[model samples]
Target chain A: MKAIHHIEKQTGKAFKLKKGAFLTVIDPMGQQVSDMVLFNSHDVNEKLSSGKSLDFEESILLTKGHFLWSNRSNKMVKIIEDTNGRNDFLLAPCSKETFEIMYNYKGYHPSCLENLYTNLKPFGLSMDDIPTAFNIFMNVQFDQKGKLSVLPPTSKGGDYIKFEAQMDLLVALTACSAEDSNGGRFKPIHYIIEE
Target chain B: MKAIHHIEKQTGKAFKLKKGAFLTVIDPMGQQVSDMVLFNSHDVNEKLSSGKSLDFEESILLTKGHFLWSNRSNKMVKIIEDTNGRNDFLLAPCSKETFEIMYNYKGYHPSCLENLYTNLKPFGLSMDDIPTAFNIFMNVQFDQKGKLSVLPPTSKGGDYIKFEAQMDLLVALTACSAEDSNGGRFKPIHYIIEE
Candidate 1:
């Protein structure tokens, strides 16, 4: 294989992205993903139900290149690989206090933010620079009573998410450090950010 | 204030735990937790660097919680809870890939086999019945190495961690989220986890 270092300039030695792009969703390699839910952080207003024609917004939100987990299994998973364009992304870690309010507060952990900072140093990112994102596989939804209900994630093991970029963007990812009891399971979600 | 419905147990609030007496670290209200390590799971050979300090193991892991975002910010952040114990606890989350490699790709996510699993679900322990842990916010000197290194974390954006149990625990904390940023800048260094 010919090794190509860095693309100093925009060289047209590549492929073109169509107006519409495609993505693939699957479970992480060697994981048994269970119940989980994922929503687009950029656009919470968009809706896309399974077994239906996904809209443009759904396409972006459910696009591959992102992943989710739940119940030690990944029911709905996606991993996006945007060749046409780029996608903006963010990475957020989980913690405890939210645990008690969310559940019986069974599982407890150290600061995931602390982990993100330590690992990001290898890549050169920082806490302040990190953007906000949805808690993948975390099934949180609003009800008719305007109450937020918790749903098990829709992702299963080995599930992945893929999508084409709508535009040029920066994506950040981390192998979350949530406790195993809640079922995020500390399983490393497969993350591949490629051109 | 209106009184909420309270149920009186005929047995006088008797509870049953695996152990007659359960031990864990604690952090009370308005307390300043200090330097300590949190593992993703219970530690077997975890050695301390000082006098015989009392320690406890979390019955489960920690995925998400509420915690103040400042070590010295003096600002009380919510959701400042994770894990059952305060210090000397692990069981934080890692990436899905890290999950596979660390465990030789044998177990699944949030499976509690890998650290990732424990991070997602703490007490529901699975796979190995307990996963290895990432020492978050703790200074350790491995037996093989004489130098002590800080075990940071991965998290950001008003992130907080807390722990809740029949009992409470105190723990020192630090916000980690810069992989390769300047001295953990994406998020500045703040030691929260206070009361």
Candidate 2:
């Protein structure tokens, strides 16, 4: 497939993808996390639900051959390829308060919530439309005691995950702005949608 | 105010609530849990987010004077009156797999997922639209060690929680089908919407 559209998503930027298309998200700088939220193109109410996806897959890890299920819809997108095999499914998208509560960052910092609202506004969506996202390329592990922590991505430059849109989709992706657990800066993400 | 509509929701039934409306969900038989999901009337992409509500209120319990925030939207519904004062905000609505994995329930048992889908279809919504819900009247508590358990509701017959819509909204509610933590049977719920 050839690229029909390319988006160089900087930290906290967002973009959309259409249906019957393939989107490959690239970690150009490597070890950086990306947050993504998906919704039906025609109906904003029909958005991806990580809880339902986890329940449907019966696993905490989303990998190749797994489908991302929207809360009401049976399938929205499918993971066709995974380079890192370490994407996170457990963490909700980082919000402004997440920075404050989790990292003790004060004042306005970059957040997936703000990025999504800013990007979605052209399509008539706002903060109310932001949903929990699939944190692509994020490494999160839980200990036996159930304590969880985010880790730096294991991906190298040019590493990517490809998703096949099961329906016409409107996806919002954010090159996360939070420091990784290892205190490394978040890097840029690149994506292309091809027919 | 008089009820514009009233529904006698048997176990596993779902219904919708419109905007600018007051919805009173009653634990008619007492100790029964109700699972509720809300969406923006014009856009399914925006659904209620318990995480956002918890963060907005800085509390885990949904009580009178608290506003339920959608993940992106600031507030979607307000708890105008809560008689039981014990509404849960932590548990996702129970699904078939939850029953199977958690309780060893076998075969076609009812589920909040199915109920929400069945009820939402009339509004042109399907499974993808079912976001995580506000599990009203469900008694869930976390122990000091952070172990969570669902306890039987403290509500008696006629106990209810009332909510006022903050936007034009569509709500799907189910009289939950899972057995309570105490192994009690799930009971019916009733609700009325007043303009």
Please give each candidate's TM-score.
Answer: 0.29, 0.62
lDDT by residue (A1-195, candidate 1, tens digit) is: 322222111010112223223323233532212112122223221211121111112121333343322212222233444221212111123334434433446654443444434434444444332222323343333322222333334555544545444422223333444444224444544433344
**TM-scores, chain B, all models:** 0.22, 0.90
Q: Kindly list the per-residue Cα lDDT of model 2 for residues B1-195, writing each as its tens digit.
A: 564233344344444556778888888778888888888878776778865665446455668998887765457999999999887654556777677766788888778878888888888877755667888887766443333566788888899899998888888887777776323776677888887
Candidate 1: where are CA atoms >4 Å away? A1-26, A29-92, A96-112, A122-124, A166-170, A180-184, B1-195
Cα lDDT of model 2 overall?
0.72
Candidate 2 local lDDT, A1-195, one digit each (tens): 565333343345445566767888888877877888888888877787765675556466787888898756358899999998778655567678777755688898877677777888887887766667788887766543333566688888888899999988888888777675323775677887786
Measured by lDDT, the strongest candidate is 2
Q: Write the per-residue lDDT of candidate 1 for residues B1-195, one digit (tens) a residue.
A: 322111111000111112112212222211222222222223211212110110011111212342222211111222234442222222222334333533345544321123223232333423322212222322221121111122333232233233332112212222222121112222222222212
> Which docking band does candidate 2 fall into?
incorrect
* Model 2 CA deviation exceeding 4 Å by range: A1-18, A181-183, B1-130, B134-175, B178-195
Count of clashes, each model: 177, 15
Per-residue error for A116 in candidate 1, Å, reads 3.1
